[model samples]
Each structure stands twice: as C-alpha cells, then as structure tokens.
Target: MEVLVSEVVGRGTVLAGRYRVLSPVVSDLAGASAWQATDQILDRPVRVRILEHGAVAPALDAARRAALVTDARLVRVLDVGTHEGYGYVVSEQLVGQSLARLVAQGPLTADQARAVVGEAASALEIARRRGVHHLALRPSVLHVSPDGRVLLGGLALDAALLGDSGGDARSTTRADAVGLVRLLYAALTGLWPADPRAPQTPGGETLPPAPIVNGSPVAPADLVPGVPNDLDTLCVVTLGPNEDGPHSPGELVRELEPWGEIRASVAETATLGEPMTAQFPPTGAAAPGGGIPVPADHDDQDTAPVTVQRQSVRTAFAQQDPPGANRPGTPPPATPTRATGLGPVPSDAETPPTGLPLITPPAYTQAAPPPPVVRRPVAQATAPPPPPEEETLEAFGFNDVIGAETAAPTTRRFDPTALILILVAVAVIIGVVLAFRALFASFDTGASSDTDPDPAPSASAPAVADPAPEPTAAETPVAPAGGPPVIASTTSIDPSDADGEHQEDVAKAYDGDPATFWYTQTYKRDDFAGFKDAVGYAITLTQKTTVSTVTLRTNSTGGNVEVRATDAANPTAGPVLASGAFGPETVLTLEPATETQSLVLWITQLPPAPEGGFRVEVTEIALS
Candidate 1:
C-alpha cells in the first residue's frame, strides 16, 4: 500500500456521503490515517480512518463483524465504505485524553493505575466472551477519562487491514495481557517500554525503549522506590522473558484486584489515630467536667472513673485550695491519709470539708393499722303517695288485634347446626364428583383405544401397527387417526434470507390455520444451494410419546423432507430417522421406538417450485 499525498485529504473532506471529515488525528506508517469526522445524517461525532484502496472490502466486513458487540469501553465502528482511492471506516468519536497524553503529563498513582488496567481487563474479558479479540491494544490507542475509565480503541479490523499483526486468536489474547502489564508499568514509572509492535501516538511518536539488562527489562524498584513489592514483582514476572507470566487478562485482573484493596486498607489504617475524645485533657478544660458532661443522676454502675460536677462554691474553693487547706487558727487540718474503721483521725490530717450534716437512719418498727369508721343514719323523709295506672290495651282490629301481636313475639337466636349440615352436604357432593371423574377416566382410556388402535396411522397409506407398550404418565393419549397431535412447543431454524418478516411465520404454521404457512426463501437450486445444511422445523410433544405417524399439508412441495425423532432439541448430531420425497400432501408412519420428546421436519433436497424458483411452503403438520 502506497501513501497518498497529504494534500489529497484534509479537514472538511467528506467521504461515503455521510461522514464529513473534521480534522486529521493520526497517520500510520502504512499510509493509513484516522480523522475526526461528523455523521451528517445522525448528527453525531465520528472517527473516520482512511486505508489503502485494496483493503476497503475486507475492512468493511471486519467493521461490520465488530459492530455486533456493544460495549462502552470500546469505540464502536459505525460504518465502512470505499470512496475514490481510499477506504474509510467511521467509528464513534471518543471524548477523552488518550493514554499516551495522560502518561506524558505524569505517572498515575498505584490505585489510579490499577483502576485503569482493571477496567480494561474487564472490557477485554467481555470481548473475549463475545468471541472478539482486540489485537491492536496499545497505550496510544487507549483513552483515559478524568475519572479513571479506560476505553480501548483501534479495533482488530484496523490491524487486519494494515497488516500490522499476523498472530492468531490465542496469540492475540496473550499479547493483550502483555500489553495491559506494559501499560500498568508505564503508568507506575512514567517510562514506557519501546516495542515496534506497540501502537504509535497520533504524532507517530514511540515510547522510549525500556532499559533492558541481563535479558529482562530493568525492574520498577530501581526507578521508583515506593512501588509496592507485590506490584513490582507482578510487573517483573508479567514482563519477564520466561513463559511464567499470566496468559490472560482475567488472570492479571484477579492478581491485581486484591493489591488495590489491600493498599487502600493499609493507607487508611496508617491515617487513623487516637479518638478525638481521648485526645482531650482529663482536667475541666476539656469540658465543663474532666470528661464529657453527664446528667446529675446518670449512672453506669461500672468501676470506671466518673466525672463529678463541682458546685459553684466547691469550684471556687477548689481554685483557692483543691484539697482542704489548713487555716492558721483551725488547729491545722487532720493529716491527709487513708482511714480504717479502727483508726482515729491524726492530729495533722487534712480532711475534705462536708457541705451538709449526715443524719442517722430511723429504726425499723411495724406501724399500727387505722380503725374502721362507723356511719350514723340520718332522719328519713316522708314519701309521696303512689300514682294510679291503667293496664288495659287499646286495639283497632277484631279480638284486640290478635292480643296485641302476641306480646310482640320474642326474637329467635341463630342455629349453627343448619350451616354445618349445608357444609356437610357440599363436601359430600364434591366427593361424589371426584368419584365420578375417577370412573369416567377408565371410559376415556377405552374410547382412546377404540379410536386410535395405532397412534399414527396414515390416511393415504396404511401404516404397520407397532407393539403397544405399557402406557406411562408422560404419554398423552392419541386423539383419533386423522386428528392433530398435541404439541407443547414449536421451533424453527428460519434462515434470515426470506421474504418480509418471515420468522414470525414459524408460529403461523403451528397455529393450525390452513390459511397461514411458513415458506423457505427462494433459492437458485432445490437443495438450499447457498444455505448451510440442517435447515428445518421442529415440534415438541406435550409429553414424551412414541409417535406413530406424521402428516404434512402444504400448497407447494419442492423439497424432499426428513422426519426425525430425538430427545434433543437440536437433532443435528445424529442421523435423521425417516426421509422421503414429499408431494402436496405427504404421510409418514414412524417405526415404534422409545418415547421421544421432539420431532423435526428437515429439508434434505429441493425441487423446482411451480413459480419457477426452488422453495417449499408448509401450511400445517399433524403428528399422531
């Protein structure tokens, strides 16, 4: 690939009708250049990389393959195309300082460095799970956000088109792990090892080659003193010439994860000191008392020292003389000494003055009970004479309205026994219904036997009856010979090359509607000339059953189909059971075998359709 003149492409140059180039970001040694661009249609920023003319189609395919994965840590390839003599790939314009730029300023702290590399490792793990290998990872291609976020750009497509690397997937992954360790080392020591394979900066500046002595890069311990022993050892071992380094990014991530946490804990522990309360002086200057102020009546009941509140007079006296001072005419104070119960006060002792006199406790004695009071009767007043009353009732009807409604009949109390009888009757009815159901189940089995002697007897052709095995609970009793089989689930391998949104047609075929169907895409030849083998439809029975026959109804039959029974959802591993050329309507009687859960209708060969192309349309399928 030859480099085009720089003047041919510059700022404001537009390519592929959608991406308008804003400015040139970088130019590779192979004449490939990446530019900042804008997507005119989507109204978003994009990065457009122009490659040699011959590499357009392959790069475009690679870009489309990379687009299948959606991860925020990687720059997304939006579109790829060729215009004039150059191939251009439009990618999401990343907004952050490149790792190269970040390192140019200064080295990162161990925590920051680990965070960047760990995040990158997680992204690599995701891509690896998705079957994507980033073979072009380098510090220059990596972007760092203000908040330690690492984004890996420069996808493998770029490397593929530029012929930068020839390593396979395994080698690529190992190289990525090595790249991460190198990035970490650079972040720690601000010295990047020189490697021709490492991606170059936009200005095409390479990192200073690491000073190597005795077949190994000089250790970070010799350059930076306080680098942790674990970190230094990890860097040395990972970058060592021996094949003992981590082989994958996950291995590196696991080894690094604990170091960051352990370092953080050590730093935190070193910063911790005595509690603020403990730092305070034990005298009154700390608080109103020697320690935290407590309510007067508060008590912990423990032997720990307590802070007693001094009264105003005591405080004043304490300031004058903390211990009781002896006055000139007070016969001096009693000597300040510990006293025992048998000892007398010393002549020169100093004793604390008491605020109030102590009173002796009262002697224990039983108190006398109070006497009961006697009530005196007062003079009684004379009562008035009783009033006269009439007890006769008045009625408007005959016989005095039935004797005044029979004394307003007494209210009746509820009887719970009637409710209990009703409940008993309901229980008896339910028991009878269950018993009848049990009796009718036998009749159902007899009816099924009478109708379906063989589970899958063909209509157009007679099928040989298979040995009737003992029925199991999982066997769904076949309905009659002509009835549809009970289906629990339906699945199909709908090749994407079909008319309209045909994947939904898979459900329509199993819906038992004669009007709807699932049709194969028109092919140039009968055997799905351009498609892979094993393109088919599958139906799972409601239970594991020995299918006797399968009947297919279709408007057009342009393929020889195979009917297979297997316990696996995917029947690709084994040979199909039965196969024959199908007409407009076809019936296949299966040989009696062990119960199978799934039945597949696969296309083995194709014939020309009536409409002049090779296709098959199946409207309905019945299995019994």
Candidate 2:
C-alpha cells in the first residue's frame, strides 16, 4: 500500500487486470481513493477502492469477512486483489440512487423512510453478529437499488480504509447502531443531527445539518410538520446529546418491523433493472386507466365506463364470496378444493353430495306468490270520490264559526289572517321610521363636523386665504428620497456555507432592480438552528457619507436585521447605524452614526418562507 502512487490510479487505469476504472468517485479520501469501475469479465459496473498509504492487511481481511455475509441488504463483494503494488476491493455498483441524492431532492414518505432504515438496521445487526462493524456509516453508504431492494455498501471496509476503530467490537457496534438512527433521522427530515465536531463522509451533506440548540439536536417534528409522534420521540431521545440510543440493531428491527413489512413485500415482486416506482404498479380498480385512477370528472376519455350486472336479489346479502370483485384486469378466483381428511375444506367449497341441511341451499317450500296488488284498497278496487264544495270554504276560514253556527246562518266569520296582516304592516311602518331617524342622525353629525361654523370673523380681520388641497397618494413620488444609494459593491457572509453562499449573486441585492434580488440559504429553523447567529450582506458605498436612515425593500418581512458602520469585509460588532426586521419596506433610522464607506446588513432571525424552512430575501437598499 505504501508503494501505491496517486498517478497510478485514475480514470481508465486498470487494477489487477480484471477491473477497469471509469471515473473517480471520491478523491483524497482518508489517504485512499475510490473509483467507479467495471468488471472486465462480467461487463458490469463495480466500485474499486485503491489505498495509497494504509495497511492493506486489515482492509482485505475485513472485506473477505464481509463477503461471506449472505444478507441481501448488504452489497456483495466481488473481488479483492493487489495490482501494481496497490490493494483494491471490487464491489457491485448500485444501479439506483444513493440515500443522500434522494434526500437532497426531498424527504421520503413515512412508510418508505422507516422501511429503508429498518432494513439498514437489520443489515448492520447481521454484520455485528459476525464480529464486523461499519463505524463510518453515512448517507452515501446506504442505497435503494432500482429493484426496490435496500442495500448497505462499504460494510466493514469503509471503517478499515479510514482506519476507524472503536477500541473494541462492542464500541464499534454501538457506533453503527447510532449511525442507523441518524440515517432514519435524515430520511424523515433531510437533516443530519450529528456532533458538530465530527467530520462527515463526502456527499453526506446532500441533507442539510439538523438544527442544534443548547448542544442538542432539535426534535424532528419541530423542523418538518406531520412527523409521527413515535418517530419524533425516538429521534429526540436517541440522537440527543446524551446519545441514549438502541443498544443493538435488533431493537430497531423489531420497532420498525411494522413499516418495513410493506416495503419488503413490495420488493419481492420487483423487476430487475426497473425503477423502484415501477414496483408499485397500479392495482385493483387503478389498473383500468393504465395505473391511474378515474377522476371524479373523468369525461370517459381515459377511463372506460363500467356497468354491473345483477342476476337476482338474493346476491345482495348472500353469504357466498363476492364474485371476484368485478374489476378491470381482475383475475378469476381459483376453484375451491374438495373436502378431504388430509386438509381443511376451502371456505367457498360447495355442499357435499350427501346434501346436508346445514350447508345446502334450502329448496322452495311454497309455490310462487301472486303478483298483482295495486295501490287502490285491497277491498275497494275503485278510485274514491272527490271532496264536497262546502269543505273548500273551511280552507279560506269562511265556513267554521265558534259558538252556535251563529245566531244567524247568514252571518260571516272573521279571519285571523287579516289581523296578522294588519300587525305586520304596522311593524314594517315603525321599522321604516326608526331607520330614517338613524340615517338622518348620521347625516346631521357629518354635516356638523364638515361645516362646523368658524367663529364669525367680523370685517375687523382680512379674510384668510383658502388652504391649498392635500396631495393624493397617486400624486406622491414613488422614487427614493435622495435617489438610489450608490453601492460600489457587496459581499455575502454566511458561516454555514461549506463552499460559497450564492456569492455570484451578491450584486443583485443592490442592482437597483426590484425583480432580481439576493437570497440567503434556507434553514431548518428561524434562528438557523444555531448553525449561525446571523447571515446577510456587507455593502461598500461608492463614497463615505453620513446617512441617517437605511431602508431595505425585501421580498418578505419579519426578520431580525441590523446595519453596522464598518468598512471591513466581514463586519464585527461596531457602531450600529440602523436595525429592524426585514420588510417589503423596512426603514431603519440611524442614531448618531459616524460616516463610513462600508456597511453591514445582518439578519439574526428569519421569518417563515413559503417553502419549508426559514429564509431572507433583500431586493434593494437605500441610504439617506
């Protein structure tokens, strides 16, 4: 391994004459290099790890032991050999996406997340039982193959290459247990809740760092809404600063078995080299429209109209099985097995030839009943006569009188409806009067205020000139007070950035264009989860000037922002010029600030963004 040189290993460089390197996957990794290669004989892509300076004995031994494990969840090791004084181990290249890449896009569903993590835990448990541990497990090591199989790569070999040791097997196993939970945390929230001091494997940052407050990782549910309570509790308790997690991987397996079962069953019928989503082809009624269910307003274009046929009313609540659930592409039910002493009878089996009364359909005992029974009475068979003309008078309250059909048969009865009408009319008139009074009262009040009599100025004083009309909103100038503050340049300051925080677009903030502005990196929490206290822009004025106010027009509002007087690239806590929340129009008044050529716009807290997480956007800045 010491003799291996960097120049000898690279793209198109063959090792041991059996594996051909395609490209470098990870470079300068822990005194070693990993390459994506192909197996010459098998004509398949394989990963080859070349050690430039390390004891190959340990790595080779570890890889050999890992190769013996039969767990399907573990990536299979194909070959390990020395080529040109370089030690290399060949592994089957994963066809699907790495956990990091998938998570970088977005989070997985609860079931998918749990299922994948559970399988990873189970795989680690298998390796632990065989006295092997992968202390360097990270997001990149775990993968979901195209066929929907969960596979863990690197196994014990990753630890060996990195020279990672836990002093004993138990310690190493414990580290792996924690690693599995971390993977689970990432799957659910797309955040890593690891110790800030520890260095993560390359490509692990596909998920952002989890928000940490007071030296402990924040709860998962706190970052992503709708996280299951059980999952949230488990993550908080396990990945907390205390590190009180499962003692063994088996514990994780049992707890996650419920979620893993669904994914595991899905994997059984997965087709090779097909995307994982293809494994979940539409089922039941969804099969009719080519894996899409019919919408409420399908319009019969993509979906075929279904018509159900009924043979008899007895089928409605019959004890017999539903006739194979008449659906598109539905398979017919298998024939029921005959009763045999060797096995139990099928549930849908027909009655035996002996014709026992218990199971057989009963025979018709009485003849078919007569059918014709009309709505007309069973005895009458003819329509009833219409009501008499005198009854109609009762309808209008003219016929029936209270005492003694009256002293005179010719006397007419008074109707109660007439009294009700009179009362309603009176109420309507009173409501109209009250409404008019209120309306007149409001008019009088307005007139008194608008035309309040100024004390009559006798001819003793000259009449005062009429006051000039106030300007309307439309007539007000929309431009800045002193015109746009000339900004010479700007720079971004974000401690959380591993490479650069959109540095190329820093000028957009002061470009004098509202539509184009600079944006800060999205974070898991409003306070950046303690990753950093603040992030914003540092502006350099075209010339030093004493400005009393600094106004910012931003894409959003509600952020803790401050402006400090400084000319340094990275501003320090100095004399503050202005400070306030980010706004569509945030105006901050300077209090006795000194003249300075440079200024810093720092935002300590951010408001919620339409996208999940918190962010800041500054479109333009002005100084006066």
TM-score for predicted model 2 compared with the true structure? 0.41
- Consecutive 10-residue window with the lowest summed lDDT within model 1: 274-283
Candidate 1 C-alpha error for residue 339, in Å: 99
Q: Which pairs of residues have clashing backbones in candidate 1?
A: 194-209, 333-349, 334-348, 334-349, 334-350, 335-348, 335-349, 335-350, 336-350, 526-606
lDDT to native, each model: 0.58, 0.64
lDDT of 2: 0.64
Structural similarity to truth (TM-score) of each candidate: 0.41, 0.41
Candidate 2 residue runs with Cα over 4 Å from true position: 1-6, 26-28, 260-624
Q: Write the per-residue lDDT of candidate 2 for residues 92-179, one digit (tens) a residue.
A: 7655566776665556555567778877887777767657777876787777765567778888887777776556766666688778
- Top-lDDT candidate index: 2
Give residue 290's lDDT in candidate 1 (0 to 100): 38
For candidate 2, list the clashing residue pairs, or say none. Answer: none
List the lowest-lDDT window of 10 residues for candidate 2.
307-316
